[model samples]
Target chain A: MNVRKQFRAGSEFRIADHHPGDKPLSSGDKPADQLRVSGLAEQIAAFQDIFYAEHRRKLLVVLQGMDTSGKDGTVRGVFGRLDPLGVRSVAFKAPSTDEREHDFLWRVHEQVPAMGQLVIFNRSHYEDVLVPVVHGDINEPECERRYRHIREFERMLCETGTVLVKFFLHISRDEQKRRLEARLQEGDKHWKVDLNDLKERRYWDAYQERYERAIRETDTDPAPWYVIPADSKTHRNLAIASVMIDVLQDMKLSYPPPNPEYFKIKVE
Target chain B: MNVRKQFRAGSEFRIADHHPGDKPLSSGDKPADQLRVSGLAEQIAAFQDIFYAEHRRKLLVVLQGMDTSGKDGTVRGVFGRLDPLGVRSVAFKAPSTDEREHDFLWRVHEQVPAMGQLVIFNRSHYEDVLVPVVHGDINEPECERRYRHIREFERMLCETGTVLVKFFLHISRDEQKRRLEARLQEGDKHWKVDLNDLKERRYWDAYQERYERAIRETDTDPAPWYVIPADSKTHRNLAIASVMIDVLQDMKLSYPPPNPEYFKIKVE
Candidate 1:
């Protein structure tokens, strides 16, 4: 039997579902293509130490994943090593009445980082296509318009020196179910689980189809999507952090040489 | 010397530097008004626990202060207790060309939180009055217009269920000097301090005068300013964290009730 067939037929097989285009590098016996742990941690540590004098490029890390894929934990564990001064994290939820009155992208456009800052978006502009398509909140024609808007938006950011990194934490339905049930049994974690999440889980396959289409449609040169296998939480985090550090280190930021005027204490 | 003598001098009193009717809580041996540490820890823990479940009220925390007045440290220390899941941090710096083209508050208004989330502003809307007035970027007439605009902007946020808590980390010039020197001498810290900070220090008295006027003019019933003395870093962090906990506790946030409809199994 192939390695994919070695797992329990019904349970573990479903928990380790692999996407069509996933090409993960191997470590040993385990299919590190689905997850790699140790390599990721070492890469994250090295990036954290190479602090640039000035953050020259703005990085927008957009994380989109189903519940229990460790979005919160990824933020805390992976980015936790970074200097807070350079990082700004924003989680976009449902729009407020005031926000709804404006264009859907108005609020998001405002949160983009200035030069020298890193902004993380937990569930971002893709919602315009994903949610509206799923719920019929927007029509197919309207969704097409949104895809173009997103491409233009990302291109504008890149042209202005913003480096956008988008990630879809790809977890198998079985893994999600296992994690959700675990939350219910864990006393302290009960508050983290919601009935709505379970409802959404029933539509998991449909959502996956939508996600695959969205990735195919909107994965532009500037803001490409990296579909990460998130069944192994540690490996998923290390992968995302490794990518972030690599991009930042490539920027070669240096603090602007102190202006000569800064040295002149004036008599005025 | 009297307990208040530290703030007063021959013919010039530090308190007198304040604008008319701008006297903040007097700063003489008045012990830091702090929230109970254990209570604060508990509140933050509870916030983290229930944070994933959706709620209705959004919160905006504004931290405005002089250089080295504990803005960064307070955020790192106080919010360090809360789960980062529900809280977003925004740090605003000097404006860029696109930002400058719009009205001063245009960029800031876009980044306010959505319902049930908490947003922290490292330096907030008050920068309109603080920075522009000091640099003479706007004349008196323009400055007054901005002050009024800022008040209205904040008022709208309060009306829309955003609990706005603005804190001014008030500290003495001597204390600021001490901290800035420490940053320079500390090996790891040396890179973070910039020469521009020293230039801004020279204009300390003018900025303080501008801040006094802004606070007295705009401190409203809905969103009031808490001018906490920030000479002692530990006390400042404790005080700010306590206030945040107290505010959230007063709001009585809870997880959204489970909806069975949202949990129904779907026929794919």
Candidate 2:
């Protein structure tokens, strides 16, 4: 289904479909999704090995979302089964004084994964558009130029063998509020919730406006964005996991043939 | 056992002792010390969970080694078991044009792990000391200044709650030659071994001398270095896994309990 087509129909952009998988909301007992999860996990792992062995292609995954939209949780739940060696995740936060002194993409460009590796941008280059657009850090003319540069940058990545997959975890304001409060009430979790988060909450409407526009403008062929419904964390995990599997399977990777002369190594 | 104290005694630097109660080089299907491996694996997994849950103490794992020293294999074997969401790996290459324009540490500092996460520097801050010190990128007086700055920077990291674990994957030159040849003979493995690797191989002796001095000088009380033998990949994984478990377990942590009482307001 064309998820983005549906998203453009109205001003209020949100996730419409929830996953039909049987992953239960409560953590008590999960009835064997391991077979499904493990199958996909093994496939992803195998694909990663081929990418490394062949040293041919690159892949990038960009995950952008509001707080409690399951960026971290979805990553944990989906890629949990793969080997960490070939996979790299870069989480971008507020720019440091030194970073702010340079171009926005300077810090990000440094973290892009090497050839034959998968790079995940957690709240990635999109921030150049979203955060600055909402906070009015740059004028409209400058914002337009920055957005153009981002598109070209990603296009260059795609040309250089990067198969980019971008996901935007869509959550409602109400769901976010409930999750934020939960973080505050939990024993050790209070540390995760900052009072500054409340300030960001106030800018929700402005951020949403900026997000939708950026999605509309930058959702090109090589780097399309998928908006996943993340209200129910379980459903969100299963859906994203399925999407990730579909991408790797499409890549048509296989484990390199086991060397027939492997026994030649005399273990001393 | 006081591993650091043992490290101080030059004679105790034997690679075999890392296996402790087992024949480390054995090729049996069953690990030489099954009980120890299982116990250590479980402890490592649990401690990583607490470290992940804490959402406060950031971790920096610096992996430095000689050519064919099992750096890639160790990351794959040990961290392969970690929850991928909570970890990020950054591999440092020879500095680019823009990177060289700045101080050596400038590029590395940008990649430091954020709060509530684990960041592995496949080669780290010590590169400023080791590479330049060996390659003549700087003079003795300037190199000494960098050595002090690195110590101070690491001390700062610890003060700011970033737990640092530095591992030196130690392997004999003969073993390295064997592994490199293995890569060449294997069907798809040849891509990882480039001509530059052979060029770099010529400097092994100089690299080792520099490493010996750096380890002795910078191995501090707060961030002591662990020199794991890479002759056997299994032993390297097992030893590093055990040390990581010890560190994370020392930092007590708990899950962020959900607020069952919060009512979810439906936005219609």
Candidate 3:
């Protein structure tokens, strides 16, 4: 199956349309699927080396999901093998005092990848649209305005040679409850367990509706969103890796040609 | 020898006191020195992985030098082996309109490395002081004020879990002339040969004097500056890699302990 086409968010995309438990990218054997993820991750790392050497194009991967939806795990599994020098994972928390002084996109714009870079945003400007809309901090018209701003901002990044990939890790409500319970039960994970996550869980349906609207309104050819079925961690990783590999392969990345003149001249 | 102590800028530090051609770190064998640099680079990469996992400390490597002093080359040689995910090289060119609207350090402060990140500044806030002083755009008092600001800014970073290592790649005027000439002669290098560099070369002595004053005024215990002899590319690489390895070793970086509870829990 063409995983990219299968997961690509369209205008008609509904958060409920896709089953979170589906394992479209997985083979029948679980261990084999896990092995496939590892192999693809290594290949992505190799491609990243050339991508850094080429030093021409930029790639930005935006990951947005509900809490306990495996954003961090996806980073560790899919992108962890890549060299830290060229790839950066920026996790956005709530805006600080200084961040609130500027427009919402101010901090986000400052962290975009430069030439020969691939940066993954653990959460992104999408949060600005979702949280506010769900809380009624911004009305529907204001939320729509912010979506327009995001589309324009992304289009600008694309025009300036950035390849954008947005992923929404889709997890079922029951899966979230299980993950949250695991956080509570595990002593080591107690540190990561926030009462706020449970509080946020109360706004589940509102968040889902906001996410669907945000993804639908801003989904463009230049920066398409991918909704990954994330209940199965292994399948989520495999599917995201597959989509990234396809995107990078289509980029036709190659290192800048060796300088012929530079070869002849010896460093004195 | 304490490599860090040997290169640390002092109150009496003068740019002319250090010879750009001196290879204090070299062992007299040229090829062997190059090999040593490669080895050090690998060791530093390994330390970086642990440092990243530790996620406690921050490292800031600031590169400052005149034109053709090998700032870019130093990044490629000493920092190239690092994983791109943990390391970032931010090249600060002339300020844009938006940047000019803010205080000089505004754009800079926004780019400081987060926890577990190592950031290299190609040309940093130092530029704010240097170019203005050299061109008489800012008077001596203004320059001194900017130096005070830098000292405080760096101190703030140091206090906040950041280990600062600033390098001034010291290359002689004659060596710079040779490099510029080679850039002009080589077809492959023509793209990198900026005409502005030639124009800036006219203010060579002024720039050197300003750099000396900047280094002397800002050098402190927490954030020390290293004067690197950069005439010999291989020696320059070796000296820098050695300094960096020494600094990172001093940091005593280690991964966060494995979570015992996490170890026991199997993913369902």
Scored by lDDT, the top model is 3
Top DockQ hit: 1
- Model 1: residue A14 alpha-carbon error in angstroms: 64
Off by over 4 Å in 1: A1-268, B1-39, B259-268
Single out the weakest 10-residue window by summed lDDT for candidate 3 chain B: B97-106
How much does candidate 1 score in TM-score?
0.46
Q: Which segments of model 3 are wrong by more than 4 Å? A: B1-268
Error of 1 at A234 (Å): 64
Clashes of each: 1, 0, 10
Chain B TM-score in each of the candidates: 0.82, 0.84, 0.98
Q: Considering every candidate listed, which one attains the maximal TM-score?
A: 3
> How far off is residue A36 in model 1, in Å?
68
> lDDT tens string, model 1, A184-204?
999999989888998888777
**lDDT of each residue in A1-268, candidate 3, tens digit only:** 7778999998789887889999987898999999999999999999999999998888999999999999999999999999999999999999996565334666887888877889999999999998878888878777776776677667767755689999999999999999999999999999989899999999999999999999999899999999999999999999999999999999999989888899799787
Instruction: Give the range of the ten consecutive residues with the poorest summed lDDT in model 1 chain B.
Output: B2-11
Winner by DockQ between candidate 3 and candidate 2:
3
